[model samples]
Target: MAVPGMMRAVEIKAPGGPEMLVETTVPVPVPGQGEVLIEVAAAGVNRPDVLQRQGRYPPPAGASPLPGLEVAGTIAAVGPGVDPGAVGRRVCSLVAGGGYAEYALADHAQCMPLPPGLAMEEAAALPETLMTVWHNLFERAYVASGDHVLIHGGTSGIGTMAISLCRLFGITSIVTCGSDGKCRAALDWGAGHAINYRDEDFVEAVKRITGGAGVDAVLDMVGGDYLPRNLQCLAEDGRHVSIAVLGGAKAEILIPQIMTRRLTLTGSTLRPRTSAFKALLVDEIMRTAWLFVAEGTLRPAMDRIFPLAQAADAHSRMEAGEHVGKIVLKVR
Candidate 1:
């Protein structure tokens, strides 16, 4: 494969709305040490990308300023110290940035080979959400088979993935969605229970659904007032893992609730983690979750696909919150 010197990419013209994402020609990025250059086939659109577009979340130091977190493609070239044989291999990788382009650079260790049956678009959708859910739900929350979990945003990419994984692992998922249709979609996706938060109280629904025992864990992406309410939905020794503060960053919690019930609250942001840590996460996922991918039993619930040039529209759909699953941009 021949690498290009310049490539088309979407750049943030300024911090603002989806319209700020402008297509332009820029020098293709070179892979640094321990990295490989990927000829991007597709890229996943995530909440962080939207935040970056709005200038709320800035790229970490030394990371790409462009807005893409995950991509799936073929290796076109390798940097120093990387195996030359890696070129031409199909892979999906989690990148810190720069995936909204014709080509992107990814850390070699962060790359996961795309199984024969997986589409590039599906592969592109997996990395960021997969890692976040795997680490938080399984690793941090310590959920096990038969455990009941409460997840917000039931129809979102992360929520759907969590529901699927919980089903595969024998855990039960109780999810909250904004609409009745989304709740139905979540149940069809194998969530044990779905609550339309707009119509009913999720805390009360979880209590009723669990026979007043509550859930073993809460996978919360919505913070603010929901924090205290989330605590009210947890069972004894239940874990609360906050992955995003979409509702609000600050919340007032009753310390007595946590202390009396032996509850645990924890959260993480993936982008700033060391490459070594992410590499280890990649390895772990390959050993465990990758088997489901290889068997064709696990795949992302895709919502929409947009051409690379229509990056703004892709972001627009994601922001509108009508999407039921992952939204991706086709770069090929």
Candidate 2:
């Protein structure tokens, strides 16, 4: 297959709102050693992409400056050290950047083969949310079957994936959403309990739902004051994992409470990590979590698909806080 010299992509024109995302034609990137060129069919719109568009979360050093972080497509070309046979393979990849484009470059190790039954849009949604949920809920928090967890933003892509994964693994999940409608949606998505944060206190709700025992852990995205409240929702020897700080960065927590209860608090960002580490994580996923995905038992809760040129509208929908699940860009 011949690769094009130029391609259309969405670029952040200025550090501002969703309107800043503009489509432009630029020279298509060539794959470097250990990388592959992807003819993007679809790309997942995530909170990190929105942050990058706003100039809050910059891409890692030497990564593409474009906003998107995940993409699904066919491998158009392979670089040195990668098998030439990979050129025509279909995959969904966790890219560091450059996903909101007609063509994107991804590490060979980061690419996961797409199952025949999966749609490109659904495959695009898997890499980021699936890996994040698996690493945080199971690996970092050490949640297991029979464990109860409190998850924030239950209707978002990450939230829905967490809900489904927990349900599949026999872990009970209590999720918090902004409206009663979204709360109901979360419950229907297999969340054991859903609290409308706008109407009810999630900390109190978690306690009530768990019969005053508190949850085994909390998968929190809202930081700041929610940190202390999340701690309050934890049972003894519980874990709290923070993924995002959509609320505020700074927080005040009682040190004595952590000491007395032997609680654990930890978090991670996946973008800046080395490719070798990501490769190992991918290997682990292939052995465990990827089984369910391959079996067609786990599928992303898709919200809507926007054309690649309408990337700004996609971001606007995500920021509006009305979407129930994953929003994707149909680049093909």
Candidate 3:
């Protein structure tokens, strides 16, 4: 990588709409201590990017405010006290922010090696969805083999990732989606069951699928309207993890029911995690799940790719809820 004074990025001039994402040449960031500079080949579009553009989500301190949370590329430079050999190694990283740029900075510890045979687009899409699924299914919800799990948004990036993960781990996945197409698609990818949520009561459907026993865990992205129903679908001692609030933020859960069921409601955002904690998770996934990628047991499903300049189109597709899998931007 030659010294370039500036690099191309989609800068958010003001938070309002997708049109606010404007192309600009910003100063190329130099990796700081414990950081790595990644020559971003592609970046993944996620919900937080839309929220950031709407003035809802703000980046953490010392982070780039521009949207995009995950990126794949070759390491271009390593910070002081880091191994220089990391430069030029292929990687896809979970980033706090700044992923929309041609170059993005990541904690070296959070960098994930690109699995052999994974395309650049697929690699870029890995970080955000995989991190969310791993945290919710394994850590918070304690999903185990033979456990019945319900996931909302069955065809979106998180949904698709969850479907793949459940299949690989021997858990039974019952997913809910809005349309028949996505429902069938989820089933094809190893979802044990798919419910057309618009036409079916997910609570009743889960009970029927699990032989009236209900589900052991739930991964919910829709919060407001679906809260009570999620509780109803949970089996005794079940864990429900809410990762997003697409349905609305505030909702009520019956206290007595929760106590009787011994259900645990938990959630977390990946970007806010400490570097060491994320490093540990990365190590854990590498040890337990990397073989899936190596053996082709797991795959990153990509919905579409757009040139970096067409970020608005990418965001528009995601916002319209039309993408079946992850949307990626080729940053080059």
Candidate 4:
């Protein structure tokens, strides 16, 4: 297993669009203490990557400024304090940045062994959405068995994973998608109900589906005008977790409703969190979600795979909003 001195990576030449992503050769990154160098087999293309490329989201300080957030690969080397034996293991990791290369470095604490039979591409899709869902739904909202939850963007990678994970844990999810086909896909992924936001109002649909009561929790990515509606769609003491501001960042919230309902509104961005925080999530996933993955109960929904050099094309597909699941790069 000879590691190359220089490797090809997709770099953002300037903040703009997909075309800004260019393939370039650079010296391979060296893993620091508690990190491992991964020979990337695949990298998951995420919305944050798109935002980063557009200059809307920048990598956190001390992080690799590359676009990719997650990767699945074999370890090429391990830094001090990490087990040397980890060098040859197949793993999927949640990285702060730097996954869009042939070789990338990840904190060992953020890495998890690949599930028994999952493919590298599928494994690559697990880290970002999985950790996001787990942190927001289970940890923050404290979603429990039999609780009803609402997930926005139900066909996106996070949406699909939330639906499946909700089902796995005995929670019911009502999801909103942009089309009839996407709605059907969400339902098939185990959502209790799917609302086509294009055809129907999600707040009304949630009320109807819940028998005039409302969901116990909501996983929201569309922040703007949907905020007040999300409030209306929640039961007393319910939780609303916002992960993204896809619609718009500014929102006029109804304070009275929040006060009357005793609701909890919170949100988090994953990249800026300390390594210790992510490590806690990794431990939890290994103990719970990993078992489901290993048993073939939880599977990553893959929409498309593109070659490493076609990174721009992959981003284009994601931006076009036709993809129903995770998009990945076959890095090899």
Candidate 5:
């Protein structure tokens, strides 16, 4: 395969709105040590990308300033210490940055083989959400089969993946979404129950669904006022894992409830974590979840796709909160 000297990428020209994302030709990135250059076929649009474009979240030191977090494509080149055979292999990767491009660099360890029968766009949708949900729900919360978990944003990429994973693992999931249609989507995706947050209080709904025992864990993206209610919806010794603060960041928690209920509150960000840490997760996912993916039991719920040049439109759709699942950029 011929590698181009220059490639198109979406650059954040300034901190502002979706209009800030501009497609322009830039030098294709060269893979560094332990890295591989990917000819990006598709890229997933995530909330963090929106934050980065708004200047609220900057890429970590030594990372690409481009906003995308995950991409799927063929390896175009391999850097020093990486096997030359990696070139030409199809993969989906969790990139620190630089994914919104015709070509991008990814750490070799973060790349996973694309599951059989999945399109590039479907594979592109997996990396960021899959890793985040695995790290938070299974790794931190120690969620197990048969445990009842409550998920917020039930139709978003992370929420959809969480529901599918729970179904694969035999866990019961209850989810909250903004609309009744979204709730039905969640249930169809394997959530045991769905609450329309617009029409019902999630905490009350969780209590009702769980027969007053409450859920064993709660996966929250809405922070602010949701914190106390999330804690309230947890059963004794339950865990609450937050991955975003979409509503707001600050919250007043009832310390007494946490102590009395033996609850655990924890969270983590994926991009800043060390490559070695993410590699471990990649290995685990390949071993465990990849089987489900290969068997078609676990798949990405795709909402829409836009051409690479229409990256700003993709971001606008994500910002509108109208998407039911992952939004992807069709790079090729």
Candidate 6:
């Protein structure tokens, strides 16, 4: 299969508001060695995209300038070292950028088959969030069965996924939410207790739930003022993984507390990952997690979807923090 000459894409002209996103025609990218061309059907919206829009984040060297990070589509072409027959298969791929386009290039190793009941939109939403959660929870934090886990931003995509993953793995979970509605949502998703951060301190709530011992691990996206509180909510030998600094990145952490409690703080990003690393992740998902997804135990909680041209509107909505789950963009 041969690649096309050009395709439609959403390009960001400059760092600013949602209005900065512009629709443009760009030459369709040809896949390099070990790569495939994806005829994108949908793309996922994430906080990184918002940060890129605001000029805080930029694509790494040798990556696309476009905003999108993950996409779902049919393979349009396969490059050298890839099976050309793979061109026709349906796949959702993790991308460094350029998923906002009607066509994008991805390494064959980064592509995952669509979940049985998932649409392109839902498939688009899965890669980034799932990769983040799995990497942070199981890989870095090593959340074990019956481990008391505390999750922040209970209504967000990461939070929803964390709640389900914790339940699926037999980890008792507590969550922090901004409102009663979000707290209820987290509870329904299998969280043991929900702290409305608006009305109460999650540190107190977590300590109370843990019988004053505190949680075994914490997944914190809320930084800044929550830093000290997060540490307080962790038990001896607990780990705290911060995936996002929504509040603020800088924090004054207690070194003695970390040493005394034997705590490990770590996090990683989906983008800037080595192809070999992601290939292993894809293999893990296919071998183990695919069955759960097929059985509906592990599934993406899809939210609002917008057409490719409406990327700006979608970004604006997500930045406003009104969404309850993953937001997707239909790139077709």
Global lDDT of model 5: 0.94
Tell me how candidate 4 scores on lDDT.
Answer: 0.94
C-alpha lDDT of all candidate models, in order: 0.96, 0.94, 0.90, 0.94, 0.94, 0.86
For each candidate in turn, the TM-score is 0.99, 0.99, 0.98, 0.99, 0.99, 0.96
Put down candidate 1 lDDT per residue, 47-95, tens digits, no spaces: 9999999999999999989999999999999999899999999999999
* Runs in model 2 lying further than 4 Å from the true structure: none
TM-score of 1: 0.99
Give the C-alpha miss distance for residue 263 in model 4, angstroms: 0.7
Q: Give the TM-score of candidate 5.
A: 0.99
Better of 1 and 5 by lDDT: 1
Comparison by TM-score, 2 against 3, better one = 2
Candidate 3: pairs in clash: none
Worst 10 residues of 1 by lDDT: 198-207
Per-residue error (Å), model 5, residue 197 = 0.9
How much does candidate 3 score in TM-score?
A: 0.98
lDDT of 4 by residue, 1-332 (tens): 68889999999999999999999998999988999999999999999999999999999989988889999999999889899988789999999998999999999999999866899999999999999999999999999999999999999999999998999999999999999999889888788899999899889999999998999999999999999899999999999999999999999987988898899999899999999999998999999888998888898889999999999999999999999999999998
Model 4 regions more than 4 Å off: none
Query: RMSD of model 1, in Å?
Result: 0.6
